[model samples]
Target: MYVGQGGLIMTEVVGMVFIIIGIPFFLSGTIGLLRLPDIYTRLHALTKADNVGLGFVILGLAIQATSWLEVAKLFLIWFLVLVASATSCHLVADAALRRNIKPWTKE
Candidate 1:
């Protein structure tokens, strides 16, 4: 059997691990959205989860890729995800701040 033949099993395991790790982050973000007292805090959770989830997913993909071309594609995907997520998060936060959405207090 070829390395690529066993690669499928390895890829499946890695993908599953990434998904499992990402689930907690995603769920935490959802919970924060529901439980957080304000928009800023909710945005924090959202951005954190988005970054973490993308990181894990990209790591899994990188592990699975065998060729230089495949790895380059994964790198591009990771870069795109990072840029998009950060830009979106910044935009949302900026919009909220501009609109004067108050942050939560510990009191």
Candidate 2:
């Protein structure tokens, strides 16, 4: 949607750029999960997506957001995901350790 009658706004263009930049972070994270050798490593990649990738996405969305309330909600959701991803990653790693899952190593 055009924010102005003349043309697209700078913020919208910047926000779209941010969104485009964010996609790779997400794809890499997904690729990491499928291709990584171990649980910890996979968790690392996924959390990168949840943290950095999602941040870019949320930021872009927030920038393009029409209302302040929407921005607030975006940030709130980002914060919650951050907390949850971190906690879950830690717990999964801890459980893996308890189960004696060895990190993959190359000789």
Candidate 3:
């Protein structure tokens, strides 16, 4: 039960829904990171799924924000996370390539 904070029940519920939706994406990404055979595949899974997950979570948080500024800040945080993850993933893949790490094969 929402107490105080103007009791915005609808927004709160919607925000929780978004958060719940995002959890699975995060979980799947983590599972992929652990189960994938190669660095490239793991990186692919981590960045793609986790980014989407974070986006959904951020959207949910933004929906529940009390003010425009809070929403903007949330968006900014998501953007920064997106940039950081992408840059780190690229760097890691490049390093792996430089080290001659081969991709996993079925055989």
Candidate 4:
């Protein structure tokens, strides 16, 4: 029930679809973070998987944005978060490695 444009209905539907798709990625990331054996694996789950989840969420929101500028800004925010997450993950993994933290193995 949007106010201005009738097109808003389609936009809202698409946004909701994207958000629904993202939920499972977030769920799996959370499960992996909790169930994984070690810091490295947990970081992988949180950084890689969760970033994708957030990306989908962001994309969904972006699709509902009123203007091209808003869409660009949303994607820019996603990119910044992605870069920061990857950098932090690498730094943390490096620190763990330097401190002699071993990775988990199934064996």
**Per-model RMSD to reference:** 3.2, 1.8, 2.1, 1.6
- The sequence of per-residue lDDT tens digits that candidate 2 reaches over residues 1-107 is 54464344877888998888899998999999899988889998999774898899999999889899999999999999999999999999999999999898987
TM-score of 4: 0.90
For 1-107, candidate 4 gives per-residue lDDT tens digits of 65677788889989989988989998999999899999999998999788998899999999888899999999999999999999999999999999999998998
In the range 74-106, model 3's lDDT, one tens digit per residue, is: 999999999999999999999999999998989
lDDT of 1 by residue, 1-107 (tens): 25467768877788778767766777887888898888788778887886787677677767767788987897798788778878988898899889997777888
lDDT of all predictions: 0.78, 0.89, 0.94, 0.92
Which of the two, 1 or 2, has more lDDT? 2
Candidate 3 segments whose C-alpha is farther than 4 A from its true place = 2-7
Whole-model lDDT, model 1: 0.78
Between candidates 1 and 4, the TM-score winner: 4
Q: Could you tell me which 10 consecutive residues in candidate 4 have the lowest summed lDDT?
A: 1-10
Answer with 1 or 3, whichever has the higher lDDT: 3
Rank by lDDT, highest first: 3, 4, 2, 1
Deviation from native of the Cα of residue 98 in model 1, angstroms: 1.9
